[model samples]
Target: MEASFTKVKGGALVLKGEKKKKHKKTKKRDRSGERDGEGGKKLKKNLEHEDMNKHGGWWQTTNLAHIVGPVALQFYNGAYMKALDNGKFVLGAPHDEGQGPEPEEILMAMKVGDGKFSLKSGFDKYLRLDKAARMVGVSDAVGAMEMFDPVWEDGKMAVLGPNGRFMSVDDEDFVVFDQDKVGPAQIIRIRSNREREDMKKTEIPEELRGNLYQVETKFVKKFQKFQDHKLRLNPNGVAELVEAKRGGNLHETLLDRREKMKSDRMCK
Candidate 1:
């Protein structure tokens, strides 16, 4: 056996041994960008798209500031191939064989083209604003009437009508497609049933809070705090986008009357 000896700095006897090698630190790989089994497709990074795919199923809106709140875009009396009436589409959960939004009222809005949407109603009919832009009629044909241009502004969604105007509810609570001016009635809130259950009172903006005109007083306490959010759905009935916008001030009848009085006096 061969013996090895070493000397310390102080001249003290010390033994020499083999030096051990240092191993490099292993790095962790990021799997977020990894592709899934779905045809080697990578996951999307857009949060809105993800939210829309999660909660963008059946949606309804209640015009919190102007007309009725939670008014469903449903069919008339759950009939097939029937038109929608704003007066009949009041805010409430649909029941079996009752005056509420039925399966026919439940709609699936999908993006067919760039900024263009197509709506399928519960009645298995396509939604159309009619050639005259006066009614939300249904059509079996996929023509210009069935195509809608959805516009989002200030958190409110508006479906473009045939006349290039937005679909809005009138003061009479009737669904009308002849709103040239953008008002509270023109703002349609899109939300799912789960969203409505989870809706809180603080979601709505203070500026939009007050009282609902041409509606019951109970709705003020009932829906004032209920926040309306938009959900985007994927082709597989998943929500890919979810967002909330603070609606503007309420459209008050007193304010309109005051403005009318002022205009009348100014005419003198």
Candidate 2:
């Protein structure tokens, strides 16, 4: 498909056009501390509080192995899903230099369960630099330690973009890339003084006073692909028959495959 933009909001994203099928724009906020671990409004509310405190990034300075050993005991006791979500999030951190790992090369590993029969590191799987490369069209079989940095330990979180490019509005300079054309994209960092002042007009409800990370980083490559063909007169949206790169022969491709699948199954 063509390039499409994915908009990341507090907890989810809002996509455009065809791929925008089920994009979620905002999150339902909740208040009140959680007690009995459960789902629904109360749990959501408690998680919101924790989220505000956590702010998405939750890499701890303490030894991960030690934390995993003890926390497993109270898996359900006083456990909050919000913390778990933050704790379980995936991020790509580079390997520090000589002493630690190369900033952009090292892989971080975190265990999920607790001691005595708990799960191993959280992101041990995506450590395959080869696999990560394939996902982003890279050819070199670089080791996980050589290629892309995984933000969320490894497998804890799922995001809609490639590594290294995405950044939150809170970054030091907060440069945003606004796609000017298909082949070329423009970086729009530093808003004007008036725009900065106008930002006050964007009032969030009292409940959503915590996050803006998820909303900002949604513009990465993955989302960009979706944005390309996401409507608004790209002209590339024209339906046509094209040859498959993997197989031989050209076949007619339907634009809305979702509807086509539904119709084929006669689920109407």
Give candidate 2's total backbone clashes.
Answer: 32
Residue 141 C-alpha lDDT in model 1: 59
Candidate 2: tens digits of C-alpha lDDT, residues 103-158? 22222333432211122223232222122221211222234332322122211211
Superposition-based RMSD of candidate 2 using all C-alpha atoms, in angstroms: 26.5
Candidate that scores best on lDDT: 1
**What Cα-based lDDT does every candidate model obtain?**
0.43, 0.25
How would you encode candidate 1's per-residue C-alpha lDDT over 1-268 as one tens digit per residue? 0011122345645458856544453222224223243324333324333533443333344332211122244322222222344313222332443233345345565555545666665555666664445445356756666676656544446667646777665455445577666655455545444344433345754534443332222323433332353221112211111111123322343234335544554697
Report the lDDT of model 2 for residue 71: 20
